[model samples]
Target: MISKTTIDNVFDTARVEEVIGDFVQLKKSGSNFKGLSPFTDERTPSFMVSPVKQIWKDFSSGKGGNVVAFLMEHEHFTYPEAIKYLAKKYGIEIEETQQTDEQKKQANERESLYLVSEFAKEYFKHVLFKTEEGKAIGLSYFKERGFTEQTIKKFDLGFSPDSWDAFTNHAIKKRYKLDYLEKTGLTIVKDDTSTGTATKMFDRFKGRVMFPIRSMSGRTLGFGGRILTNDKKAAKYLNSPESDIYHKSKVLYGIYHAKQSIAKEDNCYLVEGYTDVIQFHQTGIENVVSSSGTALTPEQIRLVNRLTQNITVLFDGDAAGLRASLRGVDLILEQGMNVKICTFPEGEDPDSFSRKNSLEELKSYLEEKSQDFISFKASLLASEAKDDPIKKADTIRDMVVSISKIPDVIKQEVYIKECARIMDISEAVLFNTLAQLLQKEQRDASRKKRSEKKTMEVVASEKKPVEKVDAQYELERKIIELLLLYGPKEEDFEELILETDEKGEIDFKPETQTKTVFRKIYLDLQEDEIEFTNDAFKELYTAITDRFMREEDLKVDDFVKVLEPEKAHAVTDILMEEEKYSLHNWERKEIYVKEKKHSVSQIVSETILNLRRELINQKIKELSETIKQQGPDDEQVNLQDVVDYITLKKLLSEKLRRVV
Candidate 1:
């Protein structure tokens, strides 16, 4: 475990904006910073970071938390990993206490998998550098491809020997389990049918140069191995099988290294192979990632979308390759991102083209040749159409399908005009085509919604239970907000005790006293034995009251660290929400707004009274239901129950007017 003092130092030194700004492009928005949401695709900036509070909120995706929480969510890091990452980034030394044997033995499955993957990565790299076979075969192959030793080591490129048991034995000797080894697809096992008792076990990527595929956070999720020798019966390139950590469709090669550069440039360069990405980086173009030879997925697109709105795809002159990637272009468009295509020279792919040209020449070629996807697709299809009117019309429809995927209407309109000119069609014709496509999609969606709704209505009638949403949900939220915002402040509170006078009027006595907001709320709730009805509210109430009992200063950063992700997000939502309205700067227009702090006492009191009234109403509802389902002698209703319900309702109404 990391010592508390070290964690505090990390938190104090690592600025939230600086950490998040590495992955996102944030523009200053008044007192805070705003950026496109890393959690979702959005045109306008909705992800806000507050340096004052050390928290961030993505209104688009409803995710919010402090710096450590952001790292955990964005990188899929364990708590300790997140802390370590921050400590390393800000150069804070971490102090870890020694764990007992039992504590050490408690490593969970995911952590074990992570450890095994990491071990495999380092072991493969060691073999490529140290052993005789690795240097002669693996290092020779990389050098032959014009990759310098620095490039090879930077990407952690490695060689797996042909001897099948070499890696398997080495791993097992290190106490790594065969279960995780096989689970990660690093080792293969085959049944020994002749013996009928034991199985054959060996390495999965023997005689192949290894490319470890990593997640955005630099965790090795899997590997892509290219065979060194050409064997007709064997596959040329093989990848790790699907596991909990490695999903190829979602994992883009070089993303871990390229994310910062992509954000820095505000544009991402997309390629198709591991070498292509490494080659681009070697050639001084750092903002490049590969889809690892798979068709683009929404998840993969979203990974780049977090860093930039613009994507430039590098394609060879091969018509087949371009055709194969057309669907990927459509996926990018569907994500509401700007995509361009830059074709390399006639006989060269990104790998070879990059290796052949100087950095300036390659960058100049890209600038001269890049085209918006609309222009690229239309021109490519138009050339293929070749003055054939029917093919030209079909080509326009295909272009319309691509254009319809764009989410921004203005961009769609611009693309439509460009397509019309390229296809020699009227602008009105393309507009109609786009409208038809959108209508058909919406109609299909409506049909699905209706069918799902019909089934849901039946299921809901028969199986769904009452929601039991506390009528005081908003009140409870307000109370929590008050507790979080003003709980440390000492303020005067007036306690009212109401009694009926001899003249049948209400008499009130007020006792004025001062207490901390936390103390006042704790005592008030305790006096009435009132608990928040919502589970989250109830949990938050307990956490706050318990924390305040032993501490005077309520540090939100410290408090949020102890909470679960969901509860931490909730607390940040309350803390960060009100500051956003102020960002618009309405006060500059000479419109004054009242400060909420001045009314804190009244807001807190009214919320508590409303909550108590709601609880009473819930009881009254129970009593009325009891009467409705009662003795056969009075099936219609019971007189005593009716009188009790009416009396409770009247008392609740009186309490609603003024709290006692």
Candidate 2:
């Protein structure tokens, strides 16, 4: 467990803007910094970071939190990992007690895989440059592919030695496990069929040039190896098999390297191969990633969704394989991404195109050739559909379906108009087609959910009952909000109790000026222990306690901008909710003083009622526990006493009933 002092230190030292600015390119916007949303695909900047508040909010995605939460979301760092990252960045020393071996061994599985893969990556790079065979073959291949020494190292380009156990031997010598090697598909195990005895395990990518595949955080997840020799039996390219850590659907090649650039440029240049990503990146187009020669998944598109909305897909102009490759464009649209297609001349892919041209020329050519999906599709299908009604109808349907995949209604409408202009079809016809498709898609999705619910019902019936949430929490939250927002107001009205100092006189003083009553009770409450039911409240309570400790003033407006937007808005809603009747200055007529509203009165009454109810409920719980401890034999209930307890309970319940 992290010490409270250390956690406070982490917050104190790590500026929210400084930490967030590392990942997001924030430009000054009033008292805050604004950037393109890191959690959504947006051309316009909607992500706001307030350094003064020490918080951030993504208006597009509605994710708002503190700096630590930002790192946890954007970098996918665990809380501890994010803390460590910030600590390193801010030069904070973390002093802590050591964990047990079992705790240490329970490292995050994703992190463990990354560590192993990183080791393998380094090992492969070592072999490529340090060893004799590696230097001759791997080095020569990369050099021939127009990769510089810097680029080779940048991509972790390497060679696997031809010897079967070369990598296995090195990994074992380094104390890595064979099970992990097999699990990650880095090594293959062989067994004798006759004797059922293990023969030997060897490297999976033997005699191949290695391209390390990485997750968004620049951690190596797996490897994609290319075979140099064109053997009839061996596959040309072999990828690490799907493992517990690497999901092909979610991982995009070069995302780790390109993420910042993509975010900075507000565009991602998506290609089709590992080499293409490397080549473009090497040529100074850092905002480039590949689909890794696999069909694009919605998950892959969503990975890009985090950084930017504009995706320019690069492909060859040749039509032979273009149709199949274009399938992903619709998926990109489904994610509300801005889809643009750019195709190179005959016999050229992005890899070849980039290599042949200077960085400036390549960049300019891409900008020039890039066309909207509607324009590109119209051009691609026009020749085939020339003068054929049935084929043209089919082509029009395909285009409409692709356009329908666009998530934004406004974008879809815009596309409909563009398609009508380009294809000479009525906008109404296309819009009608789109409506049908969307309805059908929604129906299919609903049916799938229904089927899933049936499966869940059977599974849930066999499981233990889930705990019911406490019903008083809402009331507790409301009371806490009132205390945090209005407690310190000097002239604000507050409930109080007054008693005459005579022998047997006690008086219930219903209401008084807030300052006197609150100052006394608030101080008293501070002397006693108080715990909030949730983290947000706990943080707020801590903030309040700090103020009280320092004899500092507290105000709703002072804390409003100090909290993250969601929390601030929550606080704001509570503080300002129906507190007073509206007054117009124009109609004031040198206005006489109007009596103050009963907002605080209602809040106080309800709070006191809820408090009494909570106290009674707590007493009941204690009595129940005591009865259980005493056992049924020892606790012989008195019917009359039970009736009296029930009567008081009903009175307390009646008070609570007035609150909700």
Candidate 3:
């Protein structure tokens, strides 16, 4: 368990914008920051972070909370894990009590998997530096690759022993569960009937050097291991199988280290392999990442997209590889990111090229050689299509198809003009082809939507009845929102007093009283014996009221940190509900909007009166039902009670200025 002091220190030191900015690109918007929703696939910014309140809200997903909550939501971290991450990020020393064996064993499955992966990383590093075989093999290989000790350590480069069950045996001795070991793909387990054992276990990456693949927050999700010796039957590289923590398509190697630099530079250098990223970083190019030898995935593209709108793909001299990578450019363009293509000399790749040049030389080469993706693609294909009319026509259509993938019409036009210039083709012809492709795409999308709608209609026939809005629940929610926003605020309220006028009609006389907002709300609810119908709202009401009563200084940020996750989520939702209106910039158009603070008293009184009326109506409904079901003796009493409740509701309604 992390000490409370450490957690508080972390919260105090960590800024919500700075923490979330590592995962999502945030641009300044007035007093807050807005960015594309990292939790959802969004084109426009819908994620808002308020520095003044120290809270964040994702209107797209409806997830909002403080810094700890963002990490828990985004990174799937536990409370302690989120705290530790913040403490580490801010360079705060953590104070934690050691957990007993039973406590450690009770951790959730995902956290256990993460723990195992982290343990494996540390174990592999110990093997690389401390063991003899590792020094002779894994250490030598990395050293020969022109990696310095610091670079190797910075990337957490390590080695697995050559023996099959070496790591498996050691992990078991350390009390690591074999289930997690097999699940993480660290140890391959199989039935062993001939050996007279239930199962056989062996290290998956045995005889290989280890490269820990990390999330953007630097959690060890898994590893990518490289086999050293020549084994014709074996693959050169092996990655951790998809598990609870590691999903290769959604991960990019070196992103944890490159994210800051990528955002700072406004560009990301994407390469093909792990070594390529390491070499670039070691060469003073910090804003670079790798695809880990897999084909580019949209998820991987979006990972970089969160940091920058530009990507420069580094390619080797292998023409086949370069051709294979062109499809990724279209993927990047589809995500609305600008892409540039750079290739090394005929005999070199990024790894080899960087090793052969100084930092200045590498920087100069990249700057001089990098070309806009369209120009590079056109030039390369034009050369291949030389003197072949059919190939040249196909190439032009191919470029048109790639251009059609771009989301921006202006960018599409720009690329089409550039393609025409490179291929010596007519701009009108390229535009016509693009238009046809786009039209077909739209038609296909429309057809899909119609088919989906038909299926949904069938499903809708059997769907559950729609839920009607609960007026009482809304009133309860409004009460909670008011308490969370203005709980500690003192204001004068016009309390409605019921009386019989001289003409024998019910009248509502306003009685003025000054009290704290929370006290006024609490007294009214207590007087009526009202309870929140919704469980979440009821819990939050108790928590907020208790805090307001007990603490003289009620800081929403500090108060929220102590609530349970569900209540904390509700508080942020209620507190930041009105912030959505600010996103429209209503004031920028010279239209002034009324501030809620100016009418807090009226809002509070109306809310309480509305609740009273709703509850009275509910009672009258019960009395009416009882009158129909009961004998004549009870009917008159129930009828009179209903009349009295109706009279009171009318007085409350008049106070609210609502028609009966």
Highest-scoring model, TM-score: 3
Better of 1 and 3 by lDDT: 3
TM-score per candidate: 0.87, 0.76, 0.96
- Sort by TM-score, best first: 3, 1, 2
Clashes (backbone N, CA, C under 3 Å), per candidate, total 0, 1, 0
Local accuracy of candidate 1 as per-residue lDDT tens digits, 1-660: 999899878877888999998777788877799887888866667789988777899887878998888988887788888899889888889899886767645877777777789899999899999999999999999999889999998899999998978999999898788888988999998879998854699899999999998877678899999997869888888999998788888889999899899988889999989999999899999999998888899989988887888999988767775766898999999988999998877788899999999999989988889998988998889898898999988888999999999989999999999998988889998999899999999999999999999999999999868878556888788888888899998878776576676876554466888888888788888888987877898899888877787787578777876687789888999988786665456688988778778877766666776776677677767767776787877745555565654665576566557653
Q: Model 2: number of clashes?
A: 1
Candidate models: Cα lDDT each: 0.85, 0.75, 0.90
Name the 10 consecutive residues with the lowest summed lDDT in model 1. Answer: 635-644
Any runs in candidate 3 off by more than 4 Å, and if so which?
Answer: 195-197, 511-515, 584-593, 658-660
Residue 589's lDDT in candidate 3: 96
